[model samples]
Target: MKRIVFFLGKGGVGKTTSSAALSFYLSRNKKTTYWVSIDPAHNLSDIVHKDLHIKTQIDDFLFAEEVDVEGYLKNFLHETTNRMKEMYKYLQIVNLENMFDLLKHSPGMEEYALMYAMKEKIEENQDFEYIIVDTPPTGLMLKILSLPFSSKMWIEKLIRWRKRIISHRAAIANINPKKIDESLALTEEDDKVLKELGYQSEYVTFLIDLLSDKSKCKMVVVLNEDAMSLSESLKIKSGLNDLGLGLDFVILNKEGLGTVSNNIEKIFDLPTIRMPYLKNAMDTNTLANMGQRLAKIVE
Candidate 1:
């Protein structure tokens, strides 16, 4: 991907609006842009005055989607469970059907699903010049942002244990020739379990390297002039910092008669791209102007 920009902030802070504006701006510049909404709230349609459910072309250069997170999460679980069963028939005894229901509520399920949802989009839409994401609120965004590195660690450990198991099984088969080729792989090359883990390892590593690269990925926070939004933005920055990623810029989305206080720009210690309160966000003049301001960071 040429550039992937993520817009994140607290609820009601205009993350969707800022992201939509930037998408419009990029597309008008003739940069093929894929604007996706990962937030379960799914209000990107409200910005364009279009009822969007699937990937719909907004104009000549823009394609938009409101990801069905709930449905996608169910599919993600089903696909994951099926793959696991294929690799290990032993799991059949565990009542994977019931386990799937339980796994929905399991901790980190949403985060994992959201991470994979993003991965699917980025990998599938390689032809797009720019990929703009409107992320969920702060808490979930933080969890999702941290998942790649954490998942990589978990997979690495699993890979190590899998290799050890293969080595031990090979040793056992060598000791007793009668037990060789008993429907299980005795070598790393043939072990489906090891192969699966290796694939997951590589995928998560790709996410890690992609997000850590400033030239390709940009994390923009949208915030109003308020303590709560500012507080969340700070937490977002701290989380990104811990992950070896930085908040590239911020959009101070001003709405209504409220004038923006420049203190936010100083507080974040980064350039602020301001979006004036739009009386009619979908109006041609307003969007063109909004796109101009939001385009500063991307350009």
Candidate 2:
């Protein structure tokens, strides 16, 4: 089984360290595992003490990478521009490079790019027993995680619109065969656009199904004792619930509560795992021990 785990929380909440440690702990069990950092400000390399700017083999059973989001976005946008040119011949006059520069900063592009990168990773690396992801902080993380559900609707609508256009063209051509423009006739490019849209729609559906399958995926929300942390965690919980995804655990990092634990468990509706503040300097050894403790709780 290819099990995927996501570590999520507000910034400075120790998601990167916890995810790295957990990945190492799991790898020690002789299971093939890959640790990935998708955060734009990735600290996984420093935490893991390896240069993982690209995919690197830590050992026989463990691999690591800090995903290059900009790189993926560039490639994704280039392909998208090509597709648009195929579908709309007039698009050739519009400079796509400048258009993409603006589009890169658009609302949903980053999230969709990250989602597409994830889909590529999962499909390419199925031999690993576990794939652990250290996500960006709360807001972007939720958007990235929820892209499949939200994007599917838009893609489906686009598919329908394309089909209608094709049907209308066919009807016009049937009514007046002499009036049809050869260039306007349905070509291989139009067919390719339809195929590409269908593929994208199905890919998003696959992501939705994979994430909702709790047996294959787990979402770990890391929080601290601070009130702000708790509040952000609540929003994260609510958002996940709204998207019909279940939380696997609520990790209260850097503190332990005496009697307040009951309240936390009640509010989050999941078991709580408390990690003590690190009095010692953080290192591989210390993180490994912490991961051991976390494994006991999460397992």
Best by TM-score: 1
After superposing candidate 1 on the true structure, give the runs of residues whose Cα lies further than 4 Å from its correct spot. Answer: 90-93, 177-181, 255-260
lDDT of 1 by residue, 200-246 (tens): 88888878888988998999998887778878899998889999999
For candidate 2, what is the TM-score?
A: 0.90
Cα displacement (Å) at residue 5, model 2: 0.6
- Superposed by TM-score, candidate 1 places the C-alpha of residue 112 at a distance from the truth, in angstroms, of 1.0
**lDDT to native, each model:** 0.83, 0.80
lDDT of 1 at 283: 61
The TM-score between candidate 1 and the true structure equals: 0.93
| Count of clashes, each model | 0, 0
**Model 2 over residues 102-157: C-alpha lDDT tens digits?**
67677788888899988888777778888888999999989988889988988989
Q: Tell me the lDDT of model 2 at 150.
A: 83
